[model samples]
Structures are given as structure tokens and as C-alpha cells.
Target: MRDSFEHVYQLLTCYFVKVRLVDPDFVFDIQTTSCKDKRFTWYFWCFGHPTKTYKLLRPVVMNDETFLKGRYRGSLLTAIAIDPSNHIFPLAFLMKDSKTTESWT
Candidate 1:
């Protein structure tokens, strides 16, 4: 996992670029600290299709998060909405170093 983190920025850059190519409306944000270590702070992404389709779904949005268990612990936060047909509609997702008030904002 440590090795993977070394290349995480590069990998994510490629991924975000590819996503943009396929979906011009795809949106993403990656935040990093400017400390000596340059640690990754948080990441957020929302696909183009979901953004366009969200208007057709119910207005109510539900959010949930799960703690990650591994060498580098973190939380995976997700936002979702229910469609008129009762199907789960994913709105967005976030990965952060930890679950904190600042992270939620």
C-alpha cells in the first residue's frame, strides 16, 4: 500500500483524464497539503451521467460512510439518491484520510 501511495497521484491523474475524455462533464477534486510530506488530504468525484440524471430522481439525498481497514486507514463517504422506481442512484463519493468535521465540509 505504501508503494501504491507513491504513485497514487499519477494513477489518479490518468484516471481523471480518461474520465474527462469519455465524459466532458465529469467533475473531480483532489486536495493535498503543502507540508513537507505533501500528504493527500481528500478526494471527491461525481460522474457526468449522474449529474445529468439527478434531476429526474427524488430530491431526498442519503449519505453513508464506512471505515477502511488497512495499512492506511480512512473513510469512504458516499452520497446517493433514490429514483422514482426505487433504484439507488449514486450522486458522489469521497475518500479522506480520516473522518473529521473539516473533511465533511
Candidate 2:
């Protein structure tokens, strides 16, 4: 687990690049501290297909967050919408070191 976390930046970069290659409209944002020892702060991503499909889904969007446990503690945030058929469709996701008003913003 520690080993995996150590390579998170590289893995994340590759994952984002691959996603973008498959989806030109894939949207993502990564933020890190500017301190001497840079650290991961938060990450947000939304797939291209979902953005396009949202127009055909219900107007209401639901979102929620959960606390993560284990070596790395954090919050996982997600937003989803219901389709015309009442199927849940994911819209976006976020992972942050902590959950706060500033993080939500």
C-alpha cells in the first residue's frame, strides 16, 4: 500500500492521459501543496460521456461524500444523476485529504 501511494503521481498522470486519449472531453483537475515537500491535496475527474449524457437525464443531481480509512485518510465525493429510465449515472468524483467548505468550493 505504501509502495502504491508512493507512485500515485505517476500513476495518476498516466491514467489521466489514457482517459483523455479515449475521451477528448475528459475533464480532470489535480491540486497539490506548494510547500517544500509537495503533497497531494485533491483530485477531481469527470468522464466525457457522462457530461454529454447529462442533458438527457433528470434535472436533479445527487451528491455525497464518505470518509476513507486505512493508511491514507481522506474523503471521497461523488455526484450522480438519474436518467430518463431512472438509472443512476455518475457525473463526477473527487478525492481530497479532508472534507471542508473550502474543499467543496
TM-score for all models, in order of appearance: 0.79, 0.82
Tell me the tens digit of each residue's lDDT in model 2 across 1-105: 135665865488679888999889899998887878777788889987664777898999999989987666889999998888888888999889876676667
lDDT of 1: 0.81
Clashes of each: 0, 0
Local accuracy of candidate 1 as per-residue lDDT tens digits, 56-90: 99989999999977666788889999989999988
All models, RMSD in angstroms: 2.9, 2.6
Off by over 4 Å in 1: 1-5, 8-10, 49-51
Q: What is the lDDT of residue 68 in candidate 2?
A: 83
The C-alpha lDDT values of all candidates are 0.81, 0.82
Top lDDT hit: 2
